[model samples]
Target: MTSAHPTASRQRASAPHAKEHHMRKTVRTSIAAAAAAALLALTACGSSTDSSAPAADGPYTAPAKDITATISVSNWGDPGDKAVYDGVAKRFKEKYPNVTVNNNFTPITTWTEYVNKLVTQAAAGQAPDVINIATEGVELGMSNELFTPLDGFLKNDPEAASLRKDIDPKLLEGFSKDGSTYLMPNTFNTMVIYYNTKMFKAAGIERPSDDWTWDDFLAIAKKLTTGSGANKVYGFAMPYYSFGITPWLYSNGTSMMSADLQTAQLTDPKVKETLGWVRDLVTEHGVSPQPKGADPYQLFPAGKAAMTGAGHFVTGGFAKAGFSDYDILPWPKGTTKSTVFGAGAFAISKTSENPALSWEFIKMLTDQQTQKQWADAGAAVPSTKTAASTPEFLASPKHADEFYNSLSYAKPVAAPRAYNVLDPAFMRAMDEIMSGQDIGSSLEKAEKDVEEALQQ
Candidate 1:
């Protein structure tokens, strides 16, 4: 998986006072499980305070003369992200010569901390005019009233409509709430299996087809398992985080949360079955590493693991290491073939001093030219299909198209307003189950924890 997972910094920053203050009232009525309660509270709260104020709605008409105003944009900083932002900002400046694009991006190690920081800043009225939000924070941002609905702007701008047509509708749906649009879908990541071609040939196993089933996957893994310890080439590197593990849940037609995002599905028989199946890959089959401290990002590229699941973000690291012998494939099917994804969007904060300027800035950022820059960087699949299809985005890796193609059947990762709170619960259950705990009881306990959190 990508380093998108919470890191040591997240572990140290657990339970900030500010987070408690912001989410205090976010916990709604008990919903039998923490995941359900989190989703319920998040869905019911709407927007917070003055953050839900709508942006000025109309077709954005750029001023004939350049306007001298600054648009403050906030995003979780990543190394490659700043260059893209700077490039887009430079182009926007060509249109508004005097406008200053102040990007207030800070490095963030976890989505939980990023959301907390945004919520705290909004409370103090220091919120940026434009903010980058991901699927995990969409409900939280909405519940906190952090964004203005974008429907009015899109309705009035024909160009915006054209842009929307070029994006995957699933991404737009992921960024919307209550039948209204709140964000301009930007980029996204979908899970896929990365396999080492050299290992497959050495193991004398034929490359598996995209339609291979779970049984086929197990057989392949068994054949690929050949060594032990640091020299061990495990057949697969089991994913240790929620997003990394979700494709399995999805393929089996169950998830940690229900379709409506109002109930916990952790207790479902299918969910339990999926967890057990993965656990057995480590314990019973010994084809995958014990996931506790295994880092597939390192192990896969270093050739310690034969295959691992990750998204487009992995390509950058692989390139840096000059590891070019691998390729991607869709996750092996279980009951069905499916995948999970998470998307990011650029949203105008409701409290922006310059809503019109912010809207114009967003348009520039989502333009094909700007999206192409991001696509070339290879951090994510570009939101625009045009940019995504370009050779720069596809690069030279085999089966790279699988990343974008998965969008056809991908569901957004199950994130709600209380995701920060709920993720720990799910992870704890997974940690125990992967460590050889009974799957059924672990899920039952997770459901109980969910119920308890809601009651609080």
Candidate 2:
């Protein structure tokens, strides 16, 4: 469950802009310390490349209606997630009445912990037959030989083919490496700006347009900042993790790594400029809350902040907070309008004794009907085109479609094999720069750290 995007799985309790709660400091520290060891173990322990699995061939057909099997499906055990999976399980049962599907919900505090736990289960030979992996862990899972390739299944199954056609091709490609597909994408998330409509109206400011520029955003943010001390309302709150930061980097025409994910681009001039601009939002302009003291989720819903960044997962939280007077806007344009996105997919374990049953289960989970149910439940942005465009997903907040529109220019979160080691280092460097360290020196050090991690 390592997030396809950094921080994607960590739900902050009060954040209207996030779905999951925050990871404990202990978890972050443990992940940073154990990353290399975990990577080594992951590389050493599993068979990532299997040659004997059934190949996807001509049209795939399900086994006869009487076929019976039992398979365990593993996923993050969040209540919302469990509910979505429960619904999926219910529908899957209807299609295949005799199959015994065991839902194994593992409660985890962080993406790293989730990955570590899965690896442990895998090593202990207790891994679930079907596992949910995020984009962040897809490469790691593949490296460990943890999943069975779905290429054969996809090619041979008409249902899968139809489903694939509706899914974003980029998502499909993200789960595929060197011509093999490991995960069947279920849902995805994308970054967008969520602004409190009430705050904007109160400040006498216009709502942001889809094509709004960075300067436009800044001007509006400055106007929105008012109040004092405990009553002090900030204009914006920046997201502390890569999931939130990368959109700005991408929009500014820079990225943390090369497309191949093998080279660090932290020292690029555009990146340095982006970092400096972001820092100024806090230190110079005083428009955004400092990361250490701000609770944007609460602040935004309470009318203390004008804007924050998030994905679709935040909708439920915002509703629960009774903050209905808000809407989404596409991220303001820099060099271009861009955002970061990642997908979660169900992958069959290479070691599953019931591969056929597992495959069937995967198909059911990703089928159009289930995806539509996912959309209606507001669990995530559905992966299928038809489902994504359905009224169920597009109705809320009016601009929910921004998630889909942003996809045209969105980049997947970095998922290089070395990401486990590099992720913590990059986050530390970003934190340092944002806290007023010299940007050039901070990025230079981060560049060196990433290079060293790659070597390790």
Candidate 3:
């Protein structure tokens, strides 16, 4: 419930994005004008001929020292995020002293908004040389032709092999489409249940265990719910977002969509049953807060709630709220102990003026040292296996290893090209169900809507 640094793909619709929308519109116009002038210049010089030659297929060797060009990088503009990327830039500069790196901190709150802005920039031929894209936007970004394929660079560079060996292969595979990779996995996060230890002890209930069942979780939740109305302390807070909801679906051996990402599966028996169970937590048991837009991060750490689903990104926020007695447990089992997981990747733009240099910068960003720095800062779970196991990442949270272990059972978010439309529609259905609507009817309507959207 604490609002620490935001994690990759962990977007809340409640977060503001209106200001960013207007800003992007303004920037888009200017970028369009500049692009027009550049096109004219190229036409005048007779340099606008087709240059779609295939990239060389082999291991890429780093240039000795002749590279010198400014490269632009874009990422979410959070307060702490700049510091993390600044560290990466400094190290990148150490290797290429003359190459200037410009960081474009886009002030967007959600992956959807970020991808929308990137699409606008790309349309204007002004996308950054390198971009930090979250898993939710990877498919969309690739479909827009905004990113250069990284497979050629990966196959040609020996260092790329070592880098691949360090990072999680599943993370890499998630960003690939049709056997071509468009991004290098940088950091990842997985869903987990964070419980208020103080509240559990006060309620005379034992803390959750790794293999606890959903029935056990609900029982504990009922015991932990106390007080009344405005002064009430709830047992659990259900996140209305997909990151939280998908874990329940996965644990029950179902998903919001088919594994092929081509069909909506909200009407599946297991999915509907899972939704009904979650709805019961709010209506029948009265152990969860009603979806009235209260921030769970603030509520949980304030001891207004006993448990909530979250990722490691909340750790910093919990520390800031002066609530340090909390501990994490794998989400209670349903049919299986599964969780939703996502990762962030650094992708090169197809219009990059210096693809080789951009690739080099990406290499530095995902290297073992940079991954360790990010982990030590508690920014995100390192994508690299070596960095993930290092002392820096394992120091604070006694059970931090659970995050890594959960990856074995974790499912990549389903991101079909229609995700931009499908996600919001599904979220609406979930909200309706949680608000006391009939689950069967709501899910049926949601399924039709998603199927229609996917066809468009």
lDDT values for all models: 0.69, 0.72, 0.69
Worst 10 residues of 2 by lDDT: 24-33
Residue-pair clashes per prediction, in order, are 6, 12, 8
Q: What order do you get sorting by lDDT, best first?
A: 2, 1, 3
Model 2 residue 212 CA deviation in Å: 1.6
TM-score of 1: 0.85
* Per-residue lDDT of model 2, residues 1-456, tens digit only: 224343233232445434343352224322422432343343445444433346655455666767787778876636666776788888778877998888867554554556576568558656577877677656656766667788878888766778888888878887887899888888777878989888888777877677999999999989988888898888897766666788889999889889888888889999999988888899899999887556556677777788988777667666666668889998898998888887777888776777767888888778887787667765467788888898877888977787677778777887666666667777788889877888889888888988887666
Give the higher-TM-score candidate: 1 or 3: 1
**Tens-digit lDDT string for candidate 1 (296-330):** 76677777889988767667656766778898888
Q: Which stretches of candidate 1 lie over 4 Å from their true place?
A: 1-60, 63-65, 110-120, 454-456
Q: Per-residue alpha-carbon lDDT of model 3 for 346-403, expressed as tens digits?
A: 8876667677888888988788877776676554577888888987677666788876
Most accurate candidate by lDDT: 2
Instruction: Estimate the TM-score of every prediction.
Output: 0.85, 0.88, 0.84
Sort all candidates by TM-score, best to worst: 2, 1, 3
In model 2, the number of clashes is 12
RMSD of 2: 3.5
